[model samples]
Target chain A: MDNEVLNTEPQPTEEVRVVMPLVDILDGDDGVTIYFEVPGANSKTVDIEVKNRIMTISAASSLRRDGLPVVFKRNFRLSDGADIENITAKTQDGVLTLNIPKSERAKVHKIQVQ
Target chain B: MNMLARIRNAEELLPSTLGGLHELFRSMLDQVTDLGPEWLPEGSAAGRALTVETSEKEVTVKLPLPGCESKNIDVEVIGDQLTIHAARTEVKDENDKRHYIRRERSFMDYQESVLLPVKVRGHEAKASYVDGILTVTLPRENPGSPDSHVVKVD
Candidate 1:
């Protein structure tokens, strides 16, 4: 009843325009993986950038309606130990997965006892 | 230094300086809570934007459930109410012993019911899950039926 409208009518605008997609960050032996939910976004519409140790993610969705917009964006700061040069990203089923490897010096190494 | 977790706002969480993220986070929650009254369940796996579009013939509802498998999703319609239940189980690798340091995304057990503005053919309603977006289309019960008529007065 709140959003019901006829086909000929235009989509009602929402009070809030910008939205932040939900995210999940996990750590592993190799590195860390981050997941962002931006439905309706695909490889072609997603954009990822890292500058000055700040990583920014954004995507453009095909569907637009009240309380939701066509664009999605988020930003993150890389850790000192993260290997920015080796960061990789992929978008699947509206979720963006980014993997950031640890730098060589940052990896833990066990020293042999003499 | 530890790598920061993903922040919902466009602003990155700087280690030393606590940025003025209060307003941004407040706006984010406002956008989320305004989706619908019964659109989201408390402590749901993930929050999503729900869109309802109506046409002359049918009413369509779209909800995005990322990381969900098709088998775990269930769609049911009774009368003018439509219910969607979906779950996404976490994948735990046998050899991977590493635990989640900051597990933000995992199981998505979602259950929500919405009331349709117009009567629909519950039995004939069709639903499809494509690219993480579940679209349910219900045909109107009476497409061309007039709701009101003017009586002729002599």
Candidate 2:
């Protein structure tokens, strides 16, 4: 394929009808920043977890769609360089910004001239 | 063997784009997707989602404008049409220019008009923006009629 798909879909489970919130990922020298659009989600209802090198984001919103409860859920596989322990996240204006620091090995190293 | 005309043996798997065929495909795809009708394609431009609810006395419309300032949003109700226009701006300093590797939440501007389900008193519309949801409620011009009435057969 000429264009590779960086995004992914959720696993089919009991909650197959979940609302998969869209996301955008940015790579920086120090870390990776991910923004998720989850309207009506607050800090208390949003949950972020990492297990087995997989990051799972799940949130419940007071907003209802089609008279049913709205649940935002998605998963992303983390690279080895992701410093999961030092990850941080913040929710503002219905958007969740997650920052995962890059490990020492993942940082770019320049060779010095002798 | 000489043939006057060429023939193919495969069935028409996909419908043609002419006429209503394309609309049929779009409706089918819309049904498969669980998202609301107001929501546009993912990661695209400033497409927004708005929900409309109507009752016997009034009609309410709600739009989720995340990360947007209330001052930037304008709601107008004219006749039986409701129009909303808003913008989500990016804060940038002239001295510091931050480069983004991937940006899905860039500065966006949106404007859309929707027809109200019932005649509304546009002048009596009340709008409030809170928690990124802009809600507008308008009193019905004629509240005497209910949405539906159960009639008994003799």
Candidate 3:
């Protein structure tokens, strides 16, 4: 007689960081507005960084059913017109919004008619 | 006269411009197909994302819905399944026809259903939305039921 036992325990694996968040960029007259849909992430877990004309968004999800926690990430290359120093970001309800204002020279100005 | 000429010019430009867009769209589809099923959206909803978790005493469901008001969201538990429906209309400026350099946000309407792993008390389910995450918790009807078991062959 031959009998076999089954391994019921789950094997631990390394964290998978493959998924990227979807984003939308809106170019306005004076600045640019960007929106990102990053579900399962909150303000505390999300990270936004901008340096040398590059912007990176990374976040770790708080909710999980199995395996390693879900991680969302994306990168963007900014144009020279953006004033990176005055950029502002806000996150609410799994959506992140970033406002990048334009420099003085980039703003539109009306000229007087002769 | 120049305005009419510009309009005619735009009409002439349509096919080539749209052809470029069609090529771009096809390339995007190829990229998505290359990434495989893991990159595709989950559940029946086209773009909505959802998660389901099972525990000893309860089962939980979560979804992300940003800019959605509480009044627009609907939750229903029918038989061994859970359904969530939501709609959010984005308000936009009527006069400002700002040229969009990059646009991603829009009004969203979604309906998704998830099957429960085990029998649960659907009537006693509770749901809450916090920071854009909607969480629904339902208590299992029979807590003592074994989730896994081993049988011996005769």
B1-154 in candidate 1: lDDT tens per residue?
1222223322344532445554343322211111111212231222365767777789899998877767888999999889999988664467766445445454468898998888899999988876568889999899855546799999
- Predicted complexes: DockQ each: 0.21, 0.15, 0.18
TM-scores of the candidates are 0.71, 0.69, 0.70
Q: For each of the candidates, give the backbone clash count.
A: 0, 0, 3
| Cα-based lDDT at residue A69, candidate 3 | 65
What is the C-alpha interface RMSD of model 2? 11.1
Lowest-scoring 10 consecutive residues by lDDT in candidate 3 chain B? B29-38
For residues B16-96, write the lDDT of model 3, one tens digit per residue.
758676444432221111111222333113223577778889988888776677788999999888999988765346665
Candidate 1 chain B least-lDDT 10 residues: B30-39
Candidate 3: segments with Cα more than 4 A from true spot: A1-13, A16-18, B1-48, B91-96, B104-107, B147-154
lDDT tens digits by residue: candidate 2, B90-153: 5333553433443445447988899998899999999987656678999999886776679999
Model 3 residue B151 distance off true place after TM-score fit, in angstroms:
9.7
Give the alpha carbon lDDT tens digit for every residue of A25-64 in model 1: 6666667677777777788888888766656676766656
Top model by DockQ, which number?
A: 1
Across A15-92, the per-residue lDDT of candidate 2 in tens digits comes to 322576666555566777777777777798899987766577887766666566566776665556678889999988
